[model samples]
Target: MVTTGHWIDSSWKLQKRVLSFVHIPPPRRGVEISDAIFKCLKEWGIENKIFTISVDNASNNDVAIRLLKDTFSMSKNLVCAGKLFHVRCCAHILNLMVQDGLSQIVDITDNIRESIEFVNRSDGRLLLFADIFKKVFPRFRDREPHYDCCPSEEDWVKVVKVCNILETFWATTQIISGSDYPTSNLFLQEIKRVKLVLDNGVNDEDDFIRAMVRKMKTKFDKHWGECNLLMAVAAILDPRQKMKAVEFYFPQLFPSNEAQENISKVTTVLFEFYDEYVAANDHDH
Candidate 1:
């Protein structure tokens, strides 16, 4: 299924509507995907109004966008080329990173999942587990336990620490995935928080947490080491933040020397985009 949306009003909320939901059998090729998207746009009579396309972090998506760019080139639209036309789904990238981190504690997760399944399979099992829980903790005999199985104190401590670390990622993901608000400009700030969480976790006393965070950091760096230009431009254009946000965050995002060079490059690009917009508007007028 393919869907399309646009930012609505000054508040920048996504107003999404379904475009196509045809069942296309795999193995799906880049050309086929591009053709479907192009066909949909043409049908909607908005082929020339193409802007950024957000897609999951799949290798075939890269190819699909390249094909889409070629298709767009046939039109007179000048801005439908290069990085300006491609915006990767940040939520997908975050999911990949979190999954990588979670893999380190798969055994614990599997055990928990299995225990839940066991208890949920039958009412008898649940009653038995609850009875055992009351016997195990006499102080809590007056109250019913929410869960059937109780984890060991050590296991419980580890779970709490893990949840605390993951809570940051979970919250950030929710913010970025908001369809009711602008996410592009907010990406840099949220991602910086994610990096901070990972950095802090790396120094944790618990070896398990540090190891998990180290793995996640590797994946995070692989996907988002350098900030994307679309995100930078969006942040720059926001009246509340403007360029100060970039100036404040880029130093931490890059090495001391590279930070200055990146800022200069980003500023140059921003101006170039501004010039293009001005020239286009003048021509339209």
Candidate 2:
């Protein structure tokens, strides 16, 4: 399905609606996907207005964007260079990092997942589990009972801790993926929170949590070790944050020696973009 959306400046609202759903049966290649996207954009008469396309972390998506960039370069109406057109989905990247941490306690989660499936699959099993649940904890005997396969105290404790750790990531994903608001400016702050949580988790007293966080940190660094320029620019442009956000977060994001250098680069790039915007407006006037 193809969807087109834009932010409304006056109201500060995002309006997303489906534009088309092109069907290309079987073995979908990057070129085919890009072709479909272009077709949809052309039909909507917004082909030249393209800014960024957010996609999950899939190798094929890289190829698809490359093909799209080539198409845009050939269009006389293209507004900007196509190098800035592809946005890696932040939610998907966060999921990948959390999944890496979950892998460390796969046995516990697998058992829980299987137990949920078993109870949900059969009415008889569900009823039996509910009965057992009420018997174990009679405080809410009058209420409907929810059941899960019981884990040992130790395993359950670990499960709770893991959930607590991942809850922050899950919440941040929801915030950034919201369709009602501009999320780009929020990227740096949310990512910084995730990194801080992981760093703290690494030093946790629980050996299991420490080990899990270590695995997660490795994945987090792999994906987000370097800050994306777009996110940096967005954060800088936000009135409430401006350069203060960069100054506060960059030191944590990069080595202390390199933080100031990175901040300078972002400032230079923001000025370049501002100059282009002003020049375009002058031409229009």
Candidate 3:
């Protein structure tokens, strides 16, 4: 079963240690859900020995935080109140990157939603796309043909975003160019931009990577327009050097844009350790 949250409690009785598990059920009733889990723990005779509560960056999970606070209010003597609640999940931030990134690109967002709809409505179409995709990139060998992102899955959004991006660049060069399709120089420019991002050829060596990093940082420092969530995500996804570009700018670079409102909302629920975890995990290769 897919699990999002789990809690463990321990107690010391002189030389003996006792432990118990608290499984936080799937979110059904908003933030109050955490309270239910805590109540269950109390009933099980698990005292206030919660070292940490790890959660994803979901708003409802934030409700869990509020619920914890409320529970503390009820039994101040029983709970420490300031127990560590770590809200750090790397996959979650990656998921958020897709949401924030693609939302800025209307074409990317529209195409992905449409593609998912097209695939879900017809099994044959899904098979066809998978077949064609495999032929295009045989390394993606899989028995059953399936779209990267199914509308039924939350992480499906990331799959769709990645596929749309990769496909758009590939199609632009091999299919669109020198074809009957009406193409513009502007389209070619966008394709080039995408290619530069995909290839990450700007940073070949230590010096080159440093130079590119400086240039990007300079651009970010000078420009005050917006955070360009898509651009930020492209940098985050850059496989070269473990997204050093992102490490250079953490909480400061992230929440600077209006597009980051949702991200901010989520981050606010996280403790300090959780934020650092987010920074470190995204920096991981």
Candidate 4:
């Protein structure tokens, strides 16, 4: 397991630092995970400086977050009282959404997999058989059971459409999953891309495609129904975006009624955080 930390430096620049990367032994429980995190923070002398932790949506991680929250509260009070401390990894959420949608097209995927396997058997044989195989397939398929699948022209078409839908997600994942560069400022725009693509797919004429798209939408809503406050603030702090970015993306990310309301929530939280920083600075003086 690895623990990476991100923060704004004294020069007002974002910094990414790997706090710890360790091999966790078996039966990794919340207590064990919290211990590891505490050790790393104490070593770096940033235990009290931690703001939030972003992790994948796993039951174990959920447990670990709870443990860390209890321990941290005892020493240093967290911003927003740590209500927004545990951030679910957007990439993991995207993977879950993709997997859920893919499940709806198992038959197509199975057929494609088998076709690729057949092609891999012998490239030379595949080339030679390409001409006669089409003519022979109709008769050969009659003897084969439905359980033993083969790809059809329609299956390939579905695959192509599905790939097109995933193209944006693939690109978005690549950008967000990186720690080398500042990714939070790009969050809203990237999310807008996904919402637009998914919205376009919901009206697909094919029943299977529609069903798959709906499944993906369900997962998307469940994970991203609420915009992440931390990333929202990150974007707001960015000179290129400020509050305008959130205002623009809110309508697309949420329902029409909820857009302005959520924007207010972000604005409120942003100021509350600023007040906290101001108080801390005053105390130091």
Cα displacement (Å) at residue 74, model 2: 4.1
Instruction: Please estimate how well model 2 matches the true structure, expressed as its whole-model Cα lDDT.
Output: 0.79
Candidate 3 ranges with C-alpha deviation above 4 Å: 1-31, 73-83, 86-88, 103-285
Residue-wise lDDT of candidate 4 within 176-229, one digit each (tens)? 998877887888889889989889889988887888899999888888898789
For residues 27-119, write the lDDT of model 3, one tens digit per residue: 555555665656665765643544344456667767776677566556642222343333333334333433443444445456557655755
Which predicted model would earn the best TM-score?
1
The candidate scoring highest on lDDT is 4
Q: At residue 198, what lDDT does model 2 achieve?
A: 94
**In candidate 3, residue 205 scores what lDDT?**
41
Better of 1 and 2 by TM-score: 1
lDDT for each residue of candidate 2 in 41-110, tens digit (9 for 90 to 100): 8888888777778878887778888888888888733333543467788999999988898898888888
lDDT-based ranking, best first?
Answer: 4, 2, 1, 3
Ranking by TM-score: 1, 4, 2, 3
lDDT of 1 by residue, 141-231 (tens): 2243544444555665787888898898899999999886678899889999998999999999999899999999998888887768888
Two-way lDDT contest, 1 vs 2, winner: 2
lDDT of each model, Cα atoms only?
A: 0.79, 0.79, 0.43, 0.82
Q: For candidate 3, give the lDDT.
A: 0.43
TM-score result, candidate 3: 0.33
